[model samples]
Target: MACMKLGSKSDAFQRQGQAWFCATGLPSDIIVEVGDMSFHLHKFPLLSRSGVMERLIAEASEEGDEKSCINLPDIPGGPKTFEFVAKFCYGVKLELTASNVVYLRCAAEHLEMTEEHGEGNLISQTETFLNQVVLRNWKDSLRALQTCDDILTYADELQITKRCIESLAMKASTDPNLFGWPITEHGGPMQSPGGSVLWNGISTGARPKNSSIDWWYEDVSTLSFPLYKRLIAVMESRGIRQEVISGSLTSYARKYLPVLNRHQVVNDSSSRLEPVGLGAMVSEEEQRFLLEDIDRLLPMQKGLVPTKFLFGLLRTAMILRASSSCISNLERRIGMQLDQATVEDLLMPNFSYSMETLYNVDCVQRILEHFLAMDQITGGASPCSVDDGQLIGSPSLTPITMVAKLIDGYLAEVAPDVNLKLPKFQALAASVPDYSRPLDDGLYRAIDIYLKSHPWLGESEREQLCRLMDCQKLSLEACTHAAQNERLPLRVVVQVLFFEQLQLRTSIAGCFLVSDNLDGSRQLRSGVAGSSEGGWTTAVRENQVLKVGMDHMRMRVCELEKECLTMRQEIEKLGRVKGSSAWENVSKKLGLKMKSQMCSAQEGSVSKQKNGNGKNRHGKHKKTFTPDPEA
Candidate 1:
């Protein structure tokens, strides 16, 4: 026998003969009969042992284990056997024999015994029997029913039971082929109760021909959890309208809100509002109210509409808000305040339409004047300072200079027939008798004379001629020379003069022939003698003179050719010498072998000059070396 100490304060015990008991705190030591040995147990004082007995009983009851007896020998009336038996019936039976001293071992053994033979055994046994029956009889029935509807009906009819409802629900939800049959009006195990299933109130068949039973049932709002799950499968399989499905979910949520709230749904302080899906159903008035509320909530409410539908609604509302006379005067006043606020928003710096207002020349001029006045008040430069020396440096003021440049640019853009508001100075000049002196007098006179004399010249040609005359600063003398010498072929004279000035060999012979004095006395004697030689002889003499001119021209051409060839050769030689990389080689050949010889020579010259200067400071110094004869 082993002693069992069931107490708040634990103490060891030893078996004596056939009985042992706890020494610390126990109401009584129980009697034990191991094999053939029977012994009595010791009982402790009632007051000291009541708490320990109570705790042990409570622990045993909580563990649901059996209580056994251990007898000891130091009690007032030995041990109480019936008390131990009663404790075992109501609480855990912990064996205290030496063979099994640990409480856990005793508890485990008791638990196994209870599971096999106690009251809990009935439930396990029934579940096992039911599972076996379901497997044996309802496997085919379960497989035949593809949806929750068929399963429920079969369960109701007693052909099958709820034992396989879990498996059937999973199959109905996941199996597309089985789930697909009930949705598409095909022959299947599961069929809706109504012969015609309604979709948006259009009834067709026992099952939807084009959609699923789950989709039709989504609006029913009275589906069980398993049926609802199966319905979702059918909806997904049939591609049911998301809006309808979401609306159904929202309706279900509202229906179950009270029950959900009991489960501490609203207890979370952090959760502010519940989010509803976009597909949820809503009335037009409710939707408008919601949109208006959202607009009020948003950061940028002025231009924003809650939804596309709300856009037109809000626009109509705005129009009504603006013009509806039915509104109370107080409401109208509030509306006016809102209108002012809206207008202020439209007129805000970030959203201004003022920039859209067209800016005419007057506006630009006003802006310019404002800037000018600001600049003047600040002692800063004006914005449009046309004569600011730093901005546009003082220009040439000569009438001809101004006429050639400024007037030309202005006139090119300006129409002579149109009246222009000229500058003050220009207007003042126009008031004088010869106000347009340079342009109207000299430049215009020259242009007029040229165009009148050259009537065949086009406008463009005349303009170009005038422009050239202006650019070249041609005086009257130059113009007169150009015009009078036109008969003398001034172009040829100019060409000859250019060649002569350049001293070019190519034009020397031609120049001489043109410059020959044929009207002189020597030319007259030769011509008369040549005329006496008959007409043919005169022609021959003329031909001979022409031949002499040609020969001279040919000789000059040959000389020019020779000179060009010589110049080309000289240029080529110079290029080769200049481009050659033989400076080191040349220096080496000159026997100036030292690498730093040039530097050393320069240093030596400087040192000698310093020494000569020192010597000259003391006495007259004469140079000894003579200059190089070859150099």
Candidate 2:
């Protein structure tokens, strides 16, 4: 809220003549000047109606030498609005119109006119007018807001921006498509003033201007954060994409800049406004100031800020897409939340998207650090653990899935994006096991980079990497990746190179399966990951291996797939028929659950793997130092 600080009051008995006060038909004591108009009214009414005025009169009385009249020039409410306020105070009933309502509301609030006092006071009457008439009708609300443009400095003092935005946000959420942007037009470079660039990698700035009136963009920028956040949640619920939301909000950072007052109309039939535009961004100094305000919010109120004025003792953190410090506060708040959580609340999509901005801003290392620390304190598996690969929808997997998704997105979208060339896949690779690998070409690329950089990692890691290379999992690209790898152990290379040939044969038996739903997409695994699997690269790999060097690799994959299928079938039969000769072998192969052990079932079952790739195994790769020529 902004205010005038409404200066101190004084009184003197100079006795400015009672020209207007005499017309009131009552004994005139004081003449108040507001703008060009003079109100000749009794001091008692002013004393009773306004607390501020009463205090001033009391102080003036005690000062001895005093002006007989109070001259209030340039009050927040202009003469027209004051006329209505004076009439209301005199017990006169006037029809409330959209044009005067917001102004009256602002004037009432500034005068400290109490809302609880009912319609007798301007404040209470204004509230009724807004709720019952203005806000309920879109046209009426628009009209009310149009009236506000010229009087923003006054309206802002009364915190009217939030109310106006709430009404407009409802209209926006009702039909987001009405904003009239083509899908292709989105994600355009967000441009600032003078053709300066913004959202440079991660920070965002402003929306470009055009001849067409962009009402939604303008109002969205004018709103305070609480109202803006509500608008975001509403728009999202309407299924509007977050990119559009982020793009629009880029203007929020520049809302404080001054703009031209050229008359801009709202709709064809109705109103006009000041020239509307928010530049790309504020200076670095303002960014820190605003973001610090948000950062210094208490832990609970970081996202949940409540408006209690005394809370001002707290520091302010900047709150903008471009403010690094603003982001750090949120990251710290998240860390605090995780420390106290009973379950995997961090897996929530809202939380994920909040962090996405952090990633876009290139602040994810701090995020990764927080989650890892949480994992260490929690000792691995969350309280709500997923069983084995047989179960789906386990909350425990949410954290894992979130991290997997983060890595999957990093590998797929961020790493190769020209603006974000992050090359830290080695640490990300080591964070999760290969069996837990989501399906994506980036997975293959990330793993390839990690292995190439750490060639000395021992046999165990190479073996896990081999399981990740399962024929079904391998796109032609993934296959080509393995073929190009000079570091794979002898046995692992044999498994990967031979996969496609084995899959063709193995699927004929009931042993190999690719889900029909999944078959159309990830033909190998997860939705996000499997989208780019094996089309061009796999086709080329098949030809290269057949013509030159795949004979031995094909034979090895075939033998391995055959052996695993036979052994699995034998184990199933042994479980069915007690006393079968293979019982001991099967039992040992599928380790028994000890008393303290729990049954683990993994779900969202990808197609059943024909090779023994379904088996769960976890291990860190051993490494021997190999000197790099550059080092």
Candidate 3:
């Protein structure tokens, strides 16, 4: 918005069609044509102020012609800029601004309008304004640089764009508060330049503590990508923080890459681009190149860019059909920060024609593999191994633990896709290390979902998918669900029942331990006056709860007995139908082991109850039956 007035004279130029005439009542002696526009004016002014024009006129005089018609078809700024140069030469009124200054400078250089042509000529005046005015102000420098795109080669030769970029980069690399320049956010400027510091030297507000440190992102995002790329390189060389640089890249991508914002891509039926600006749409090829370039510009540091943003990039990459290297690079980066990802982030839709699944399961598998590799290399897990009494939902869970949960949720989401093959689902589910999942509830749910959607899977395939979940690690609720789940393989059902029985037995044993301590706890309470009755009532209430729990366990044991009998019958039927020796042998093993284990587990519960009654009467410990470990 900064302006420099070069002349005090009123307007003396008038346009007649494509020809601009000097209205000084003088006959036109020179016809200078720049592009489609012609300038008709006195030769003295043009010859004295422009070295090129002087030479052209002298050459015409040498050729025995008094008049010269010069054509400048390749002028840097074309006709619009030449008009300003012509006015400057005629001493007509002319104004220089950040937007027009660079064009004028390039046009002046093209005409050789230096001080040698005349003192304080167009070139020197534009140079002084650029160095003193345009370069000193932030917005002015940006505006000036933006004008260079039309005449890039000329601007480069004059170093006008380089100077503007350097100025912006220097200011961006430093704190805005230090210079009190305007800051921008969400496509709007937050304050006027020098607004941060009041006239009295009191600071207005030091960039509200919560505002982003990269407030300049929006300001720089308006630039054309090539200029933006150069500015970023300069900023990086100046040591701007990587996160801030990342923010700027994100902003730039959001503006230019339409797919990133819409979260949708052009399909084969429609190659048209979404409108990024008013009536402007970037071509699919351009967006593809932009995506790859942005990926390349991203800093290599992990955790600086949000994982969700990375996932978005991968999604957009698939849509744009970007290079394989770009896609793989994004996947590796996502894996490094996989812990920060959400289930929604991992649910990338399948975009490749060759893929059949509803989601990009294989891509997620690769990412999980990379995450495991990084986790192993970094030693991200705690010292406690999975066997060292670590449980799921621990407060001190590691990064892989969170990633495990995230993947489980993702699997559950993708399981409903019938196109998802057993091998792909199983591979993705099994990619998470055992140590990562201390509990199999999440994995169990995912497997269940897969089983429900894929009822046509062979029994062996169902069993293989179930193998990814450890029955012992499943919580009681999951075990209960698995016990009655008809979708599960018979062998898996048996395992679920066996673990549920063991877990119930352990619960009963804990109840007995609590009962053993009950007397001491009651005696401890006996010292409080009027609390003896209350203590007995509390004990009675606890005993009732224990009795109810035991009854439920006994009922569960009977149900297991029935289930065991039914399973044995099925096995016998299978053996009779198959008539294979190996089949019979396996069926016999299953029936015998399952029947004996069910019987022993039942007797153990009975003996425990009897021993409890006897201890209450005799005040003595009794030996109780222990089930066979093999059974």
Candidate 4:
């Protein structure tokens, strides 16, 4: 049910006013409420337009409710869209635009306003609107597809998603530089200095609640899986690599890809070359365009090409009757056709096909054949070649070298899905050069992804694989973790830091510090075969560091002793210059006399004491009679 500005054919008349619909000056029998909006109108028109409304009215009457209002909870659109649908049902001409077309179409479909009674009705008009207006512009079509929250349910119900995708695809393929349209220009792409402009308002861990994701990055989050696959497939067919597309979209979803929850009833359309189930074989002109699109990808990184496009290219090749033709001739044709841009765009990945892609796109196989064919066409083995092992290897430091190492580990480590994944991985590993040192950030990341997928791996096996990693490039956290592990030798972990100072000192002073392990200290120290139990034993590493420091301290001690002796001699010479030696001799004699008197006092004799006045050496004691006379 929708709330529109219902006018009189009733006992009262209403005009468009700034009050609530129910509060407006209209005498109405029934009030229909949809969300916060209410439509005060006669029940007759609603019954005629919507069976849903008719059923609600019938239920209300049976319940004999005093309120003659029917409330539609959980309806699709807001009040504005409902108003548009209401007016359309009342025979009002609807003005459709890209902004409101998707929502309006769904609203019409929900209200059953599209069921025509011969003449052109709202539904027929909507169909015409879609074909004539929405389908014509790539921006409008994608906007409708992504902006419409219920597009999957509504578009699926109306069976328009596939049609919309098809139309969008046609428009996209016709454009130059098909993938970067709207964003890309003759010089560059439309992006902020930092990244895409969409990254401005939203960031990681922050998004508005209750609002559907609307940015280009999050736009795909609302699409069904099949629709998402179709979108990617179609774009790739136009010569847009998945890497470019995914990289652009990944700006908002920076850490990872947004998970899109698809509708359960989404149709499964598998047997098609193009996305949206476009027929397998395109027209000859279209094929030329497709071939031209494939031609554009040459001279670029082969890894940049999405497997889906490879599949589409292969499918097109098969349909063009080129798959069965001599691949060498095809290579010659490619060279002849694109002399200026001739380079190997397609080449075998170092890893297995399935591991490289979500679907079994045989991207690796096709690239290998292309490379091989190019080699044969040129009449010489390519820089990369296939050996007797069916393994592909190249001397250049291409991305495949790293992928080969990854495949080797992935095959040996992962066990559950290995049956479906083994042969390809084995071949990839075999292709890797024996002397190839896997020591890049990407290689480590690939290894991490593989190990994370298999949680039950034994510790020793994990350690062995990880040992191959370049410790210098390891992250700070990884270094800390490796240092803490009991299995790894402390020396090895410390050595991985590659500190020249630590190695230099440890190499020289083998056992300067006290050793935690006694027997090992003797073995560790050079020229010290005899072990001293519970003595000044030190580890081999700490020896050099301590010896240097301790030797400097001993030399410093000798210098300090010489300085103290010189200061003492200077003090004695100053005393002699002042003639204080005579006072010293007198004081020494007086001290000896005092000491003899103290010895006599211990034998019950009185000892004399000297004062500053030098009058008496002893003080007299008064007898009892003498003290009385003196008082």
Candidate 5:
């Protein structure tokens, strides 16, 4: 701390209880009563340096009052600071520091101790020390600003608060390392000004090399909210980066808002300070206002703040009972960069009194809507584009795809909540555009979870929820799960079977294409018999997994074929009783028979191919069946 000694003389005042009497052995000519304390002194020193005191003394004399007492009921800093002022007037030794400079300045201003009363009055002396010593140092400036809260009106009138805030802002905006100030990253050891690395006062003898922009966050976080607000405005007006401002805001919130420390969202940096207990440091109402103010001050740009931090703010907002607008603003911001959020970030527990679900499903739905709105406004180009009259996938869909996956995972997490209504579940599932999901595996899992938790959903309701998934997009594993899942509507299981069969056929056709290519290669290199045989053997070795998969798929298709046959037989029996409607329903719902027969024939031919070898006269193996070009 910076200190300025004002008086050269030894202490010449004695305090007997609340009354301080000068020790010059002269009868007291004047008494200045400040709150509970009284200063008894001669008139010469008080009259020379204090304009207000001189006028009060003259006014008392003019009123024909013999008493020489003057009461300073509204004196800034009250009796404690008045004691310093009294000592200065009497030329007793007095030391002024950053901690007390603001108090002395405000008190001096209140007493009208200006240069007009003396050559170098208390006001001018404090101002010079503040400008030259206190404001020039980072910690000193913060300390001075913190002291202004007790005498806000006087400090504002004298511009001490403004000067201190501006000084702190200037220092905060500059790189602390540029001027040899000790700098520390979040959660790292704080370095003392003496260049010693300190963690609870243990020296590690290691100095940090690079400085972070958050070096001033801890220092400035100690200021009162009003002063901090002014400092932030000044920094913003001076063109400080938004990211820096955001970091400071996050730091301040972490220190002052206790809920953030308790929330599940992982902060980018661990708070360097301990969690402040609610009602201990700030009242609940004050915390609420602080959160709203911080929300208002956040940068409007996207990607500048972390999504997790936004979630933390939102959770805290709900706990603090912040204004509706503040909560909405947080949701919009979260939506703007929602692709960066994880499932855990969106798992905010229901805080409403209604308590409809385990998690706030409706809030997440709104956030998803905001994300979609932003995507639409930015002309979210579709991931698929036409090339040569055929649509192809593009990388432009990365963000929406990520969000889709994130939402699917979130849905699965909330699916177990029985209180989550069916419509709400369906709405959230359908929020992401169809184009965004190239694969429905994640969506299927979530839907399946919802179905498992909600067994009471009727067949029609289950089908309606299942419609959100495109069967063609299901991975083989999901297809297998869906095929055996009795909880799914029978119609959905049929669709899953049909798509699974179709996907298997496509795989078999691909294998046929590769076999044809290999055969062509073998024919072309027949003259090099050893090389040809070696290459053929290597190709077969590489495709062993594909052949195994084909075998499993062929068996699955055959089982589906038998299932279709059984279903057809049952439909025929129903048609005899229910007229032609059952036949028509079979035609519409069980369209898998023809494809199943095709798979059967293909499997038969493959079996025949393995059992019998078709060798030419030259003893070279020959392909027995011709591939259908359409296949």
Candidate 6:
């Protein structure tokens, strides 16, 4: 067989012992060679321009084989080109091809470099390197921060601590020691007074005695002699002025003295000497100067130094004590003044005006208007209950009391009139037993009992009662039904049933009567029954007797009704407002047109059945009856 084709579109040819084939469709620039057998392939023009062809050619050349048929993998054109080339190629490893290597390199570069490739492993390696660099160079970063002149100025002006300075500097440099000078040398703790020329003797050269050098020496000795000596020598050699040295020494002393004193006290008790007293050592003029300095320092301390620093110094005792005591004393004096001022201000009319004044004025006017309205509504009734001189008078009682009386009068006036027309009670008693009399008496008695039981009720109870009575009207229909159907007599029935219901409804109301006789035989007394002399005593007794008599009469009527149900039923049916003569009378009185019918449940049903059957008792089909809708 002719050399078996590796790809379908490849042209088979032979050279030496290996098959040499050329791919029909491959990029021109991609020249593939395997062991002296060469295959010239051309990629798509776009792929060549896009560098894909150049990449393939480069990969193929690196393999350096020119004898075997070269296989062309799939390019951007299609798999047909790849299959065509593979079929024609021979004597070559099928998998270890130039195209495969080039594809893999492209994939690796794309996957590792582009954000869309999702190369988490590569990203992790990059982040780790960055973190290590930052951590390793932290000291350098801190030093860089301290190089800022603004930060140095702030620290110096505020007289900040060495630790604070170091911390600030460390924020910017990896090696903070790069900027830090050794503390033990170069004007540090290692230098001493005996060997250090600056500290051994005072300057005695031709420098003016009262000039900058003298002032510097004074400041150095006054603040911290040891540190001052070292600082003086460093400044003197560096050509710094006496005033500058003095100011620096003062700043250092002010900032670190409290901290040093605290450390010294803890380390050596004997060295913990009392602070020198300014009052005892300094003159009045010097004291004035010190106080001025203190005031100036207070503003600096407010923002820079922590308050704990000041409190650490025992020397601050006098100032702290004076400040606290003065504040407390000033508060007491102000409190006294405020108390007297409030009293004095209240006594002056112009100084005292509030919403309460307006409220009170409005309340008084409203009260007067209310009383006048009440009097007008009551037909100019007298406020007093009785004309008796011995009894306490009711002189324009409070609104609450007025309301109570109004309810009593209204119920009394309406009850008798309504009760007279009730068939159940009216047939038994000639006068309806003055149900109002018992009602009024019981109500008043209940109020009196409530007051006695709960003395705290005082004016509030009256107010509550007044509100209950206001705008309340008796349901005349309900009262009539209750009187008739309840079988209660006009007298005892009204009290036992009606008023008892009311009492039960309101737990706040107390007992209705104070009768010692459980039998109710000792002549039921009315609370507001008696007239002038016997002081309502006779009226009270007469009212009670009348109530009892009405109750007895109601009992007789009930007995008679039980003996004669027919008679009672007829009487009830006739009296019912819905279908009876009474209803007709009421309708006429109320100016309503009437279409009367006998009202009975059975009668109504039978009428409906008859109508539905379309027949009457005569057995003849009757015309369907349709009652008037208006009726």
TM-score list, all predictions: 0.15, 0.35, 0.82, 0.34, 0.81, 0.14
Task: Write down the worst ten-residue block by lDDT for model 1.
Answer: 613-622
**In model 4, where do residues sit more than 4 Å from their true spots?**
1-26, 51-68, 78-80, 90-94, 115-120, 177-230, 233-302, 305-631
RMSD of every candidate to native, in Å, equals: 39.3, 20.2, 6.4, 31.0, 7.2, 40.8
Ranking by TM-score: 3, 5, 2, 4, 1, 6
* C-alpha lDDT of all candidate models, in order: 0.32, 0.46, 0.75, 0.43, 0.76, 0.29
> Best TM-score goes to which candidate?
3
TM accuracy, model 2? 0.35
List runs of model 2 lying over 4 Å from the truth.
1-31, 40-325, 332-362, 379-395, 417-423, 433-442, 447-481, 484-631
Candidate 6 per-residue lDDT over residues 123-202, each given as its tens digit = 23222322332112222212222222223333233232232234322322223244342223323344332112122333
- What clash count goes with each model? 12, 36, 0, 7, 0, 48
Off by over 4 Å in 6: 1-291, 298-302, 309-631
Q: Please write out the lDDT profile of model 1 over residues 1-631, one tens digit for every residue.
A: 1123222322244446655443434444444443344433332221122333334345544665444343223221123332332223333333222112112222222223234234433223323333432222212213212222422442334332343344333332343454342353423334322333434444322233443324322233334434444445455455544544544443443333332133444434242222212223234443443333323322222212222222222332333332232212212222222212221121111112333322111222222233234333544332221221122322322322332232223222221212222231132222222221232324333334434444565544543444322222333344334333322222222322222222323233333334344324335776677645465465445545544544443344444344334333433444356434553343233222121222332343343333221000111112122212111
lDDT of 1: 0.32
Q: Which stretches of candidate 3 lie over 4 Å from their true place?
A: 179-212, 263-281, 382-397, 520-631
Across residues 1-631, which tens digit of lDDT does each residue of candidate 4 receive? 0011222222222335521342324466677677767767666656666656667778887888655887765555566676665665454444676557777777666666645432444566667767765665444565566545454677777667766677655543443333332332211233322222223332111111212122233434334334655665666677754565544333312212111112222343342112222223226654444344333333333333343333334334433444343333334333222212211233222233335443231443334345434444654333444332233555433434443444444433332342334344334333444334333333454445545554555666565545545565444445444444434432334333232212222422332222224334445653465545533434433444443443433343333334333333443544455567865664444334333322332221111111101111111221111111111
TM-score of candidate 3 on Cα atoms, chains taken together: 0.82
Q: How many steric clashes does model 1 contain?
A: 12
**Per-residue C-alpha lDDT of model 5 across residues 333-397, encoded as one tens digit per residue:** 99999989999999999999999899998889889999899988887746564332233575556
Better of 2 and 5 by TM-score: 5
Candidate 5 global TM-score: 0.81
